[model samples]
Every structure is written in structure tokens, then in C-alpha cells.
Target: MLIFGAAVARDRAWDVAVELAERVGAPVWAAPASERAPFPEDHPLYVGGLPFATGPLAERLRGHDLAVIIGAPVFRYYPYVAGPYLPDGLRLLHITDDPAEAARAPVGDSLVSSAGVAMQMLVGALRRDRREPEALTPQEHRMAPHPPTDATAADAVMSARQLFATLRSACEADTVLVEESPSNLADLHAEWPITEPDSFYTFASGGLGWNLPASVGIALAESDSGRRRAVVAIIGDGSFQYSVQSIWTAAQHGLDILFVVPRNGEYAILKAFAELEDTPGVPGLDIPGIDFVALATAYGCHGVRASTPAEVAAEVAAARDRSGPTLLEVAINAAVPSLL
Candidate 1:
């Protein structure tokens, strides 16, 4: 079994990891922040990204006899859990360039080296006596679409779950996604599984507002390369406000960025956390009465709003066809979504 990290794609050796997975009949994955599966998501052996929690992740890694983790720290966890990193009875191998990460892995044969080089060496060593590899089922596949039948466009709010599921089918396969919308992230993952390397990126830090600026950076890089790729950023309304100034730079350069702001009108994730911990309601949570279209205009970019699934599809399609930066403000429900 092989687990990849964001650094593998950064090194442009994600293909090496994919080849190793195919050779060993193991599924491929990256860290949550690195869900951009180095291999094609449609491949039979391509599993999705691992969860952030140690318990759920340990459960997933339990059955494998040997696990090969490369490029990433043995683990990058959020919300903090204290326990054995890996499940018992699972012998593991960790390969990474960061010596500090190698020294800190709780249980693994740590090898400090380049991930690409290590994988190349392993591939060369395994091909001496070729044999048919065993079969493994891919655990990552799309669920049936569940559109919101009861919702109405007149309400000026769409369901986030419905929005993500519909967005996947609407967007191009090769489109690159920059995600900052934490509310419906699990639904987003289920809807748009990463099929290619560097196709999907999210801020590794648990910070808000980075995705918007980061999207502008990626868009400029692609523009400079003379590529016509659809680079879209999905931001929570709260996060979108964090680095909204960056949009001015994107507009100044005429980068063709499609920024989608899921305006849920509240810090929905924090609201959920308050519920989980049985705390009192928090103040300064709701984000109300900010005209995103006006904000976009002020930044010298085109802007539109969508409250229905059909409108979302139309706006996204139109934005993709354009050659300059556009912001599509999606008025979504304020319902708190569960963390995956």
C-alpha cells in the first residue's frame, strides 16, 4: 500500500508513486491536504485521500501488511489526537526528504531520501522477476447524485451538498480546483474525486483566506505557460473576505480565474464545533449584507450571483468560456455540514 503526500506532486514524481502502486497492487492516496491523487481517479486501484483523524485513518490502514508512505510527514493531523500513529501489527516503511519528519514517525522504517529517487530504486528492484500482481478493490467512487427537490431558487440559497455534486458533473475533467470551503468538504470530495496529479489543491494550514490568493497565483502561472486550463477557487464566504484584496491583482493581470464563493451567511463550521462541545452560541459569526458583486466590481473583475443549481451550471459554464477573472457568488444554505 502506498500513501502519497503533497510534496510528491510538488517534486513532479507522483507518477513514480503511481507506478509503484500498480506494481504492488496497492491503492494510491495522499494526505487530506494532498487529496490530489497522483494517479487517475477512474483507475480501479485508485483510492481517495485518507481522513485527518488518526482513529479513522488507522482503521483504514489496519488490514495492509506493509504500507509505503512517501513525501509527506508520517502524518499531518488536525484537531489533535494522541495515540499510536499506525494500527498494531502493521509494519510500515516511511520515505521522505525531511529528516525531522523521518525521525518523528512513531512506528516505521524511516528512510531519509528523495521520494522520487526512493520509488525509482524500488521499481527497479521489483522488476527483476516479474509476476502478476494481486487484485485490490478501489474504495473511492462517486455516490448517486442527490439533488435538492424541495429547494427553490426564489429562496436565494442552495444546498451546499447539492451544489458540489452538481458542480462536479458540470465542470471539465481537467479543471484545477483550489478549495477553502470547509463546510461541505466531504461532499466536495465525494463529488469531484481527483483523477490527475496537481488537479486539486487546498491550504495545508487550517487557516482561512489562503485559497483565494493561491488561486490567483496558480492562474497566473498557467497563463504565463500559455495554457488554457480552467482554474477555479471554491471559498467559504468567510474565507473569501479574508484575502479579497488579492482579486485586484488577478484583475490587473487579467487572469482567467473562476472564483466561487459559497455564501452560507455564517461561520457554519465553528457553529458546529460549538454544538459538539456543548458551548453557548458564539458572536460575530454571521456574514450578512456584503454585496459580492459590488466587491468584484471594485476589484475590476466581472461578478454574478447564483442561488439555484441550474443558475450555478450556467454561470460556471459561462465563466469557463471567458478569458478574464470572474467571481460567481453562490447563495447557499446556512446549515452546518458535518466534518468528514
Candidate 2:
């Protein structure tokens, strides 16, 4: 089976894979990239990472009777070469957090729900069936070494670990986290442990500039229920540029939302890729100094700039006290290694 999504969805997908494999007594294939660590690599049922081309992946699944995909995108990219992974009449089941993703993927059956809830339901059903145990083999336990940490403290104002811990501590149980900084999510996921279901975490459809707007949607949902759950959006500076207008909506609605901007003044992910390819720097990647706080103020939302951990903590606390929208601009060192 195949599953894909953001970090939070990836974790839910893994849970679903584990339960399904055990119930059907079949091996499970996980394709989370090396960047997403702490996954159950020790499991023997793991088939290995998914290949880049569909031909190879389909060839590997030649005799499989069913294909289950979660979280992962089906139309991520195209390479032209194609073959049916499932034989004629084989069943295909897909689960995804995004309804759009579920609707877009080629599938016979699909479930549209948060990945966490869908996984819990699937596992609960399997447990009711009292399936036999199908554990991983010893050989499959061997996995690639962990990715090296190449980020320097000077590159980022605060490490992803530090930022998550601070936020986790400052927020209440009902808080919702909307994440669009895809490049930093690996580190964020590894550092944060999600134990509650209400703490909704969302990622874009492998697309940029959805973070701020998505957070607004989540906040509006919470407001409709008359719940006091705080909505927090951790967005990259580059991503925030895409839907900056959302701030005005949040202010107009008086939504209790906080926008955390991890500013590095450049598309750090693209720069890293370019460096790896030994290519000259690309144009329009660098974002010169922009006062995000001022932009937020222009939208009638409270704003603050944080350059240190203490300042971040203080600003977060202040935003939490406010009853309306606020923006916290964090000047992170752009030199940090890409968690991808």
C-alpha cells in the first residue's frame, strides 16, 4: 500500500499501514523520505521506500491483491511511463486528510477524514476482527542511517526542536496547529508528539502558500463551535507571502489566531537544492528584509517581531492573552539545514 501527506498525516498513515498489514497478514510498504525519521523502520513488514517511477513500484506490487494508500499524493508528478500496479479486479482503498486529494487520486474506494481519526477507525475495526499477528522480519529492520544535521545555530534563530517545545508548552489542549512550512516539518514532527485528536495539524497539497489561509479556515471552524481553542499557524516567510490577505479576514472576523513567521529572507529549501546541484543561485528566491509585523498591523491585527527564544516566548504569551488576531515575526537564520 502507498500513503503520502505532510508529517502529521504521514504518522497517521503509518499507523493505518501497521494495522492493515497485521490484519491481512501482508507486508507493508512505507515511502516516507529519509528526512522523516523516527518512523518504525525497525518493522520487518516494511517493504522499503517507494521508487521514483511508477513502473518500478507497480512491478514490485505485481501480485498484490489490494492496494491501500494513505496521506501520500497519487498525482504528485508525472514521468509518462505507466503500468497498472494492481491486477485486473484488484481492490484499491485510499485514505487522506484532504478531501481534494481523495477525490483526485485514482481509486475504487476512498475515505475522507482527518488521517488521525481514519487511522483510529481502521485499526479499531481490524482489532474487532481479531486478526492474526504479522510482524516485521529481522532483515527488513535494517534502514538507512539518519540524515546528518548540517544546520548551524547561526543559520536559524531557533532550532525546530526548540520552537515546537516552546509552543507546545505555551498552548492549551484545545489549540490547533496549521503547518505550511513543509521544508521544516521533518524536524517539527520529530520534535513534537501529538497525543490529542483536537489538535488538528494540516499541510498543503504539496503546494505552497496555503498555510495562512488554511489556518483562517480552521479558526473559523472553531469559532462556529464557540470553542476557545487557539489557532496557530507556523508559516515560512516565503509561504506567508502567498496569502497575506488572510490576515485581514482574521482581523475582520475577530478570530483568535496567531501567525508565526519563520523568516530567513530566502527560499532556503530551493537554495539547498541548488547548492546540491552545483548550480548558480536562482533569481527571485531571496526576500529582502520585510517587516511582517507592520504588514499585520496594516491589517488591523496585533504584531510583534522576535529574534530570540525569550522574545518568541514573550510574544506568544502576549498573543495568547489577546482576544483577536496577532502575528509574530520570527527572524530565523536561513542557513539551517533543510529537514527534507
Candidate 3:
């Protein structure tokens, strides 16, 4: 199967690939890097990135009888090749969140839902034919703490581990979490697993500001269906600012939602990338001293700010007890890497 798309799609597609592989008992092969399928090098099922030409990969696919493409366009780029990438007479199915992509890809079968939902549906359909895997052993479940020696004085306040641990404690079985912390994704994936069908997590698409809006959407969906699930959005300060205006919509609709902002003074991810490049700090990356609490208050929602892990836990607990919309900002150390 060729799974490709935005990073959000990549994250979701991984889950989909896991389910599909288990169902069909087929080894999934991915193409090389293009705009669509940017396969994570660290992942186990990754074949390799697609090259400018597909002749080599197409030859490899000649043995497979069917190809299922998910969350990517039919063909990202031809690179001057005027031939079908699929072997002659091979069956193809495509699935995507975007109907436009499904229409453009011309799939034999198409499903319209987020990648996570699609995976859930596929897993449900395959459940009769498959047995559940064993749960993680207690030893495997043990996670290490963020090493204190690795932290600088300025980095001691709120580490990613602290944030994720606090959230994990507070999360209910039915909670839906929409995450847009690009730099914190690895840490989160390492710490959290989807143990229940109702526990949903989604990240940004190609768009920068999806967390807040997606939380609102999920909240609305839950409320309209009379479900008691909480919709929580975890956003980084840099990404939150992109769609800060969405808070008003949540407040207006009276959606029961919790918004948590991890505030560092700069675009910490980009700053780290700059350090890797051995370049000096880029100007305008630092956004000093913005009042997120007051911004939430202005939008007619409850707001609170916490500078320590304890305070963060307290504020989140208080927000969860409320019936309406609320925003809580946790001030974090910006200098440390967001993921281990």
C-alpha cells in the first residue's frame, strides 16, 4: 500500500497501515518521499521514499495483486513517466479524508473520514477474522522520567514529559484529544496509546492551525449526539496563535471543551532546527509575554495560566469540572528539546 500526505495524514496513516496489514496479512510497501507519502524513517513498515521516477518501485510492486492507497493523491508527480505505476490489471482501492482526493484518485472504493476513523472502521470490519493482540506487559508500560541533568535552569519549569503525564492522568476513557504540538509529537506517541475506541487523537493537516478548530468540531459532534465525552485540545503557543480566533466560535456555540496551551517564548522547534544548521537565532521567532488568559477571557471563556506542573494539573482538573468552554495555558521551558 502507498500511504502518503501531510504529517497529520502520515501519523493517521500509520495506524491505518497497522490495521490493514493485520487484516489482509499483506506486507505494506510505501513509496519514497514526495509531497504525499513522507514516510517516517524510524517506522518499521516503511519500504523507502519514492524517487522522481516510479519504474523501480513499480517493478517491485509487479508481484502484488492489489494496491490500496490511503490519504494521498493517486500520483503525486509523474516525473516525465507516461505509464501506469500499478502493474497491468492490478486492482486498486483508495481512501482519503478529502473527497476531492478520492475523486481525483479515482479509487475502486472510497471512504470519507479522518484517517483515524477510517482505521477504526477497517479494524472493526476485520475483527471477526482476527484475534486481539496481547496488551503491553507491565514492564513495557513503564516510562522513564525526563532526565533532570539534561535540563538547564531555564528549562526546569514544564518539560514535555510533565505535560503529557498530567494529561494522561486527567484523560477519561471517552475523551477526544486534538493535538497540534508538532515538536511534541514524538514524545506524545511514545507515552500514549489508543487503548479504547472512543479515545481519539488528531493532529494538524497541512494547515498550521487545526487543533483549536478540530477540538470545537469534535466537541460539537459529541454534544449533538448527546455523548458525555470531553474534547480536549493540546496546542503549542506558536501553533495556537495561528487560529486563536476559533475560541470565540467555541464560546458562542457553548461547546464543552478544554483548550491547553503550552507556552514557550519562541518557535522552539524552528529555533532547534536553526541551532542544528549552526545559524544564529532568526529574528521574530521570540514572542515575548503575551497574555493568553486575558485573550481567552476576552472571548467569553474561562482562562487560567500555570507556570509549574502542579499548577498545570490543578488548572486542568478545574477546567474538566466545568460544563462550558475553558482555556488553560501552561508555561514551559523553551530551551529543551520537546521530544526525547
Candidate 4:
């Protein structure tokens, strides 16, 4: 099985990955840190992102005897929890550019090289030996277009699930997402499966407010290339406030970026963490009276407010088609989500 990671996605090595997978009949897996899926999730031999914890990951990889890691670390974990690193009896072979990652991994034999080049050589050797890998039966894609009814509007306001489904339906196929709203990622993963390379991005550093600035930089680069791909930065109000100044830079450059701010009036992710840790809800988590629309207009970018589904779709189209930057402040339910 192949584990595709951020380096692979950033390096644009999906073509070689597909060739290697096809030749070896190997199942491909994506990591959560991966910007977008290198291998199409619809492929029969393609697996979803790995589980969050060590125990859960071992269970998920139980059936696979061999794990070939490509362009990613052996594992990137969080939560500071301790457990078994890998399943017993499973051998790992890594091919990556970073020797540090290979050396630090608990268990793995690594080949230091360009992942694309290594895969090409491996495919050539396999062909020379006339080795025929197992062919998997293709299966129909299982993702549903919309989430459950209860998952949509919470407290009669647009929910996280609703926002993602609406964006998925409204945006162009090549549109890419730069995500920072951690509380809503579960909804994105559920409704919006990564079908294309470089279509989705998120910071795995667990740091807040970084993606907003990064999104602006990505917009500038994409605009410079003259690609028609829409760049949407779907961020939380808390995250947006941290780097609100970036909007000025985006507007100054006339970047064609669509900033979608889900206004829940508080740090919902932190609330979830408080519940998980059995600690009291911290003060100063609630944010109010921040006029994002006014801020956007002052910065010379267009802004809109959308509370209904139809209104949101219209705003999405406007943001995507506009020549300059635009911000859509969507009022959403202030419901606390489960800790990731």
C-alpha cells in the first residue's frame, strides 16, 4: 500500500503515483496533512486518510502486510497521547526527499531520492520482470451530495455541513479550498471528498490564523499564473480576526480570492477542547461586534452577507466571478462540534 503525503501533493507527483499504483496493484492512502488527495479517492485501490490516533491507525492498517511511504513522513501525529507506533509484523519502505524524517521514524527502511524518480525506476523494474500485480474491481463512488437533514441548519442558522455542501455544489470543479476552520473539517471530509490534486489545503501545525495569510499568498500566485481556478479561504471568524490585515494586501494586489468567513461569534473549536479536557469554558472566547463587511469595504474589497442557501449560492458566484478580492461573511450556528 502507498501512503501519499504533503510533499507528494506539493511536488505534484500524482501522475507518477498513479502509475506506480496501477503497476503494483497497490492500495493508496492519503494523510490528513496532504493538501489534497494525490490518488483519486474514487479508484478501487485508493484508501481514505489515515486515522487520527496510533491505535486506530494500527487497526486500519491491519490487513496490509507492507506499507510504502512516499513523499511523506512515516507518521505525523498530535494530541501528545502515547501508544504503539505501528502494527507488529508490518514492514515499511519509505521513499522521500527528507532524510531526517526517514531517520526519525520508529521503524522503516528508507530510500532517499525524488519520489517521482524512484517510482519510475520501480515501475520499470517491475515491468522488466513481467510481474502482474493484482487488479482491483472498480467500485462506484460512495459519497453523498448532501449531509443529513439534521446536519444542515442548526438553530435555524446555516450549519458547517450546509456551508461545505453548498460550496461544493456552487464552485467550479477546479476551485481549491484553503481551510482554517478546524471545527468544521469533519463536515468537509464527509461531504467534499478530494477528487483532484491541489484542490484542498489545510495547515497541520494546529496553529490558528496562519491559513488566512497563506490563502492570500496562494491567491497571488494563482492569479499571476492566470489560472481560472477559484481560490476560496473558508475560515472561522476567530481565525480570520487573527490575520485580518492580510485582506488589505489581497485587495491591494487585486487578487481574485473569495474569503468565506463562518461567523459563529466565538471560538467553537476551543469550546470543544474545554469539554474534552473537562475544564471550564475559558473567557474571551466569545467575539462580537466585528463588522467584517465594513472591514472588507474599507480595505477596497467587495463584501456580502448571506444567511440563506440561495443567497449563499448567489454570493459564491459573485465572489468567484469578481475581478478583485471578495469576502462573504456567512452567519452560522454557534454549535460546538466534537473534538477532532
TM-score of each: 0.87, 0.67, 0.62, 0.87
Q: Which ten residues in a row have the lowest lDDT in candidate 1?
A: 141-150
lDDT of 2 by residue, 1-340 (tens): 4333443334545555456556655665543332232134445455443433455546655665777665554534322236664456567787666778678876457777666576667677764564454554422212111122345456447765566667767777667777766556545544444334446455323467766887898899988988768888989888888889999999999998999887778887666556545674678889887989899999999998876677778888888888899898876655534222
Q: Output the lDDT of residue 257, model 4.
A: 90
Task: Please report the candidate that would top lDDT against the real structure.
Answer: 4
Q: Which segments of candidate 4 are over 4 A away from where they belong?
A: 127-150
Off by over 4 Å in 1: 127-156, 276-280
Model 4 lDDT per residue over 218-240, tens place = 88778788875789899899888
Please identify which of the two predictions, 1 or 4, would achieve the higher lDDT against the true structure: 4
lDDT of 1: 0.74
Candidate 2 residue runs with Cα over 4 Å from true position: 1-67, 70-75, 78-149, 201-203, 273-278, 336-340
- Give the winner by lDDT: 2 or 4: 4
> Which ten-residue region of model 3 has the weakest summed lDDT?
139-148
**Regions more than 4 Å wrong, model 3:** 1-20, 23-69, 73-156, 197-204, 273-279, 336-340
TM-score of 2: 0.67
TM-score of 3: 0.62
Candidates 3 and 4 compared: the better one by TM-score is: 4
Which is better, 2 or 3, measured by TM-score? 2
Which lDDT values do the candidates have, in the order given?
A: 0.74, 0.63, 0.61, 0.75
Per-residue lDDT of candidate 3, residues 236-274 (tens digit): 888889989899999999887888887867787666556
